[model samples]
Each structure stands twice: as structure tokens, then as C-alpha cells.
Target: MATFETEFLFVYGTLMSGVDNQWSLRLWRACGQPSEAKVPGRLYTLGGYPGMKDPLDGEAAWVHGQLAQLPDSPALLADLDAYEGDEFVRLRRTATLRDGRIVPVQVYMYQPEVDENQRIWSGRFTFAQ
Candidate 1:
């Protein structure tokens, strides 16, 4: 398993800022502010939420999200891991900020089988209100 070397986390779904979910609120409270960032991947609509996966060959799309600095707390990490459940796995990846600077961040990648038709071409996910 890979260990998280940086305190940054990239969230692309309901966990992104402005979402009213309980975990999103908790994460915002603990991680302070967030900045617009994107990772090289594809976003898909997984029911009410969204999932991210590696981009297809020669694909230049990016999964748009917010990057936040997590506090140094193991309990918080454990809680996030539990919230993600078995359908997602955390991995380290590079995120490109709006200003074009690349950063290392930990992100949850979708693990279950995906239906290609559910792909979100916009790359940015918005939870329906």
C-alpha cells in the first residue's frame, strides 16, 4: 500500500466544498479552505454521487475538484477511509492548480465496474440540489 506523503487531498464529488453532506462539512471544518485544482482523470455519474477513474488512452480530460490541506490527524484520515467504503481506494496523484502549479495529493479512485455511458464529459461534478 502507498502512504500519503503530503497533507493535501483532492475531492471531486459530494465531498467537494459547498456540498451539504455531513462528511463534506466535517472535512471543510477540519481542512480549512480549499483551492480549485484538477487531476488527470475522468469523472462519471455514479447515481447521486460521482466517481473518478484513470483517463482513457490519449485522453486529455481532467477531473475538476478542490484541493484542501488536511490537518495532521490520523483519526480524521480513518474517518475519511471509512466513509469512502469498499468501492473506492485512496491513491496519491498530481493535481494542477488554476495557476498551473502541480501538487501532490491523495485522491479516492473508483474501484467498481463503470458504465461508459455514465461518463461526465464536463469533468466537473455538481450535486443536484
Candidate 2:
């Protein structure tokens, strides 16, 4: 089990704030508030959810997400790790907040091979209403 250096978690998919999912609800409950943030990456639609991949060389793109403050509890981290599954790996990355502050945050990166055609050019991911 890897230790997290920061308490901030960057969420871009179902775990993002305001999503009507059980895991999202639990996340919001643990994290009282979240701020709009963006990370340098590419977004792709992995079926019903979105996955984020590191930007390729010379690729200028960003992944819009939220930065949530997580409590200092190992249980929560364990839960999150389990929820994300093996396809995603939690990594530390810098996020630019809406206020222009850059901070280190934990972000989940997609591990499987990505199809270039499936890229989400908008960067932001929103559940279909």
C-alpha cells in the first residue's frame, strides 16, 4: 500500500462532486467541499465512465475535475482504492484550481491502452442527464 502525501484527491468521473452515485455521495460526505481544478491530461470515454491518460508528447490538453479534501483516514483511502479497481492507478499530480492556485493532488490514471479516436476533446466529463 502506497502512502499519500497530500490530502487532496482529484476526481474526474463518477466520483466527482454532484454525481448521483453511491461512491460519489460517500466521497462528498467525507470531503465537505470540492474546488474546480484541471490537470494536464487527456480524457477518454471508457464505456459509461471517463478515464484520464497522461498527455502525449507535445499534446496540449487538460482534464477538468474537482479537488476534494480527504480525511486523514486509512480506511477511506482503502475504500477509494477498492472503488477505483485495478484499471486505475492513483498518482500524485499538480492541479490548477479555479482560484489559480496550483497544488498537489491524488489523481487516478487509466492503465489500459487507449484509442485515440475516443478522446474527449472538451476535457470535462459530465453524466448524461
lDDT of 1: 0.91
Q: Write the per-residue lDDT of candidate 1 for residues 13-43, one digit (tens) a residue.
A: 9888888989999999999899999999999
Worst 10 residues of 1 by lDDT: 1-10
| RMSD score of candidate 1 (Å) | 1.4
Task: Give the clash total for candidate 2.
Answer: 0
Measured against the true structure, the TM-scores of the candidates, in listed sequence, are: 0.95, 0.95
lDDT agreement with native, every candidate:
0.91, 0.90
* Clash number for candidate 1: 0
Error of 2 at 11 (Å): 0.3
Candidate 2: where is the Cα deviation over 4 Å? Answer: none
Q: List the candidate 1 regions with Cα displacement exceeding 4 Å.
A: none
Candidate 2: tens digits of C-alpha lDDT, residues 1-129: 477779899999999888898889999999998899999999999878999999989988999989999888788888888999999999989999988999999999999998988888999887651
**Residue pairs in clash, model 2:** none
